[model samples]
Target chain A: MHALIQGIILGVLTAGVYALMASGQTLIFGIMKVVNLAQGAMVILGAYLSYQLFTSFGIDPLLAIPITTVAMFILGVAVQLLFLRPLKAEDRSELSLLVTFAVALLLEGIMSVTWKTSVRSINTGYANSSWTVFGYQITLVRLWAFLLSIAALLVLYLLLNRTRFGRAIRATVQNPESARLLGVESSRVSALGFGLGAATAAAAGSVYGLLYPFNSGSHYDLISRLLSIVLLGGLGSIGGAVVGALIVSTSSAVVASAISPSWSEMTFFVILLLVLLIRPQGLFGTTARGAI
Target chain B: MQLHNRLRTTSSLVAGLAAIALVITGCASKGGGGGSTAATSGANGSPLIIGASVSLTGDFSDSGKAVQRGYQLWADTVNAKGGILGRKVQIKIVDDASSPTQVVTNYQNLINKDHVDLTFGPFSTLLTIPASQVAKRYGYAFLAPAGGGPDVFKQNLTNFFFVQPAPTTQSGDVFANWILSLSPADRPKTAAYAELDDPFSAPIAENIRTKFEAAGIQTVYKQVYPSETQDLSPVMAAIAAKHPDVIIGGTQSVDAYAQIKALVQLKYSPKFMFQSNGANSPLEYPNKVGAGNTTGVMSSADWFPGSKASGSDAFTADYTKKFGGTAQQVDDNSAEAYATGQLIEAVAAKTGKLDNATIISSLHSGSWPTVLGDLSWGANGAPTGEFNLVQWQGGKLLPVYPSGVSQAAPVFPKPNWGG
Candidate 1:
């Protein structure tokens, strides 16, 4: 029972970061029809940046988030403007897969060359520190990461719902032709949307460095999991992403703690299989989804 | 129309002629120059190239990176001393990424393309299994620095050599003897009740079972979990329900870490929890799992910096100076990798030849000083060395067995245990 409770707490804490990362993926998909497969690589790049800042400049990872996010945001804008913007609308969806995959490869190459493909973990003094509530141990870093993820997601929600730029993005997602008729710049929205997606990755990346050890190629695994979450969350829905992350992380943790550790990894895929069986469109997913 | 057709026909004919010439040249080169070049590359003059395929990027990256560092340091030191056998040596390294498919491909490239005389490793048993076949097929001297799972070395590959002791042959024996040393009444009844599995842990688990059964201890439960398992809770809970007096962790570090962490969280403290080589590298097991939690957990070790073994003090001093930290059992890995170079050097000095066959023959018969003391290989290519048991006490690993090597007494009557 204690293990179960602890597993739930761990799952909940981990979900926040997963939700943030998935939100970016979904956001990009909403405004653009591209899948943006490079989202995972961008997350890994953010992690490396945080690691570099912590190691080289003695900056705390949490403190380095603003820098990493802004830097990645700029990178995302450049990528969309240069590589993603010029494709014909008809070809955008199919071509974006190859383009984003290329971007992932490019980031991986730069990271490998700079860091030499070594797995690194940030060992803060509080790495092992945790708080026990109701017989559950919650890692301090994980708790903070969870709170930070929620805060970031809330900010993202407000930005999309309460601002003019948010209106434009939503308008474009609902009807691109209508959005263009209203004089909303679809191209500018795409560049900013990509930047926003990359921004969330930076936030999640900072917390990721705190929770796990990573290297250049870790993005491969991260990307696979992120894709699973995004698909399970219904492709372009931010709210669906949060729900999907909870289900995936909670089930895996619960299985690991209650059923068998060996079966934990399989549980996620199994759940995904079951979900796809019943709800092919995903829990909150719609057929009329925007580009990645 | 006639002019256009004629132009197309001439271009096609030119392309066909060029293709034919290229194929002829390729066949000629393969039949003659390829053989000559390969012969010259392997002949008396080319620099000896050694290759290693290791996980430089994933979970086992720490161990792989350290081994690489040690390998590099040894190579650099040797080259600085005028090279091995007076011929310059080059080490070709590839990242196996901890995957078997990548390992096989990398192994082939290293052997066939890089033309390394001897190869060191793609660390982890998963990668080692497929990679071993590459060595067997090509007859390259494969000196594996790590990856001590039983199946990896259980093959008929005479070209393969292990730098570490087999898991079952080491940990299984240690745990069984320790169990026997306990009073019969104190010994838990269900041999079947305690289960352990890790691809690397299996040998030790099997060894433990064999030793217990041989000693006439009846085991009531047994199961083997594949290495890919990310959870061990169901097994642990089942064993706890059976109320076994001890739970042996046929565990590597990650498995051990996960198992112990789970055990503490689940609050299913066994009478004892014993770990395998995977628990050897990290010196902070007690701290990681909490001091009292791992107090009575027993495991065999190849080296303990705290031990009073012969030359251990000198090793600690020199290694500490060189690495900027105290040498833990994990250093045994780097030491073995370094010793591979030294052994090669010793053999090359004797034969005065850098060929694979000559070096292998010499290596089988050679005995040399190593960080672990005098080192020699058996006909089976496994190390002809003994290991000792150690228990974690107050955040330190204390050698507990083989009276001569022990530095501190095993802290029996652990802080919070059934005993």
Candidate 2:
């Protein structure tokens, strides 16, 4: 029983970070109708940047989040402008897969040359430090990571729903032609939306580096999971991503605590299959636009 | 009219027969030359191309990178002294990306495109499988830095050699023997856990089980978990119920580390020993979790710092001076890679020719002195399998067994809760 309770706490904390990462993926899909396969690579790039800053300049990874996010935002804008923006709008939805895959490969190559493909963990003093609350031990780093993820998600929510740019983005997603006539430049909105998506990755990346050991190729595995979460959440919905992350994380954790640890990873896939079988789209996904 | 007819018929028959002969010869050459290019390259007098297919990216990336670094370090040292036998040696490296398909592709590319004379590869067992197949098919000499399965040797690839002892051989026979030698009162009940379907992990887990039984410590339970498992609750609970004297884990460093953390949180006090692979990581286990938390845990590996016996001190000094830190983890692969560099130089110096067959034969016939000891190959051109057992003592790795190599007494009564 204690194990189960502790597992739930762990699951919730883990879900927060996954939610942040999945939100970025969903946002990109929402704005451009492109899956943005390079989202994971961008996250890894963010981690590497944070690692460099922490190691070389004595900056804390958590503290470096703002700098990393802004840098990644610019990179995201550049990628959309240079690589993604040029594609014909009619052909974009499918062609973006190949383009994004190429971008992932390019990022991998660059990281390989710079870091030499070695596994690195950003070891902060508080990485393993934990505290016991109600007979459940909580790692300080994990707790911090969860809180930071939530804070980032909240910021993203405000940016998307409460601002002029947010309204333009919504208009484009709902009606591309109508949004353009209302003095909304669809291209500029997409570029900013892509930047925002990448900014989320940087925020999550800082936390991710604290929680896991990573290398250049880590993005391959990470991207797959993020895709799963975004798809489950109804592709374009940020709220859907949060709900999807919580469900996946909680189930896996509960299984790990209740049943065999070995079955936990498989359980997520099983649940995903079962859910998709019943709904076909996702929990919150609409067959027409929001789901893949 | 009769002379003209005779002349035309004779010339036509001669031309037809000559064309038939040429076509037959061409067909025969193309069919017979399929694998001969690979064989001929193996026998060629050109600089021996030692192909290395290694994990340049992923979890095992650092180990693979370190192995490559050591290999190149050996090569550079040899070349600077003088070209190996007046012939410059070249090493071709292919990054396998730690995937099986990529490993096969890289191995084929190395043999087909690079036309490598000899090959060394594949730091892990999974990647080694396909890489070795390519060597066996091409008839090129292949040496693996860190692949040895009991069944792998059973395949009997004539040109393929494993330079390290089998996972079972190293952990099962030697380490277990030492544990069993401990007095009956000190012996504890044991249980083992491993990641199922992992070739290197399963054998070690099985070997530990057998050895623990021999020591009269009955195993209450044994379990295999999926590779993707992040939590170890079920197995830990089953083992906890058994209340075994010790728990042996056959897993990677990350999994082992995570399990230990979980176990500590659950407050289960079983004497823990991680399997050989996870135990050998250069990273300090005790430092990862404070010394007090990691005490009484035992692990064995190819190299340990506490062993003043044999080449331990020299390797530590040389590696520290060059790499700016102590050589915490020096496995058979690392030492062999260093030795390979030296051996190639030695052979090249004596022969002065870079013939593939000559280098392979020379390496097979002679014994090479290495930091680990005399690494002499048997008739099969594989290292005479030898290993050293080490235990973690107060956050320091010290050689404990193989009585001849031990520098410190085994920390018996393993400092417990109050220590």
Most TM-score-accurate candidate: 2
Cα-based TM-score, every candidate: 0.71, 0.75
Write model 1 residue lDDT over A81-104, tens digit each, in one string.
Answer: 999999989999999999999999
Off by over 4 Å in 2: A289-292, B1-146, B156-169, B190-192, B213-245, B260-269, B283-297, B305-332, B338-386, B412-419
Model 2 docking grade: incorrect
DockQ of each: 0.12, 0.21
Q: On residues B20-124, what C-alpha lDDT tens digit does candidate 2 reach at each position?
A: 543454354443322324433234345545778877876556667767876766655555555454444577787877665666667666665666655776766
Candidate 1 docking quality: incorrect, acceptable, medium or high: incorrect
**What is the clash count of model 1?**
21
Query: Candidate 2 local accuracy as lDDT?
Result: 0.67
How do the residues A1-292 of candidate 2 rate in per-residue lDDT, one tens digit apiece? 6556766777787899899999998888888898899999999999999989988997889999999999999999999999999999999999999999999999999997999775666866666566777656676777898999989999888877899988888888777788899899999999998898999999898888877767788898889888888777778888889998998787777776656666777788887888888987677776665321
Clashes per candidate, residues 3 or more apart or on different chains: 21, 1
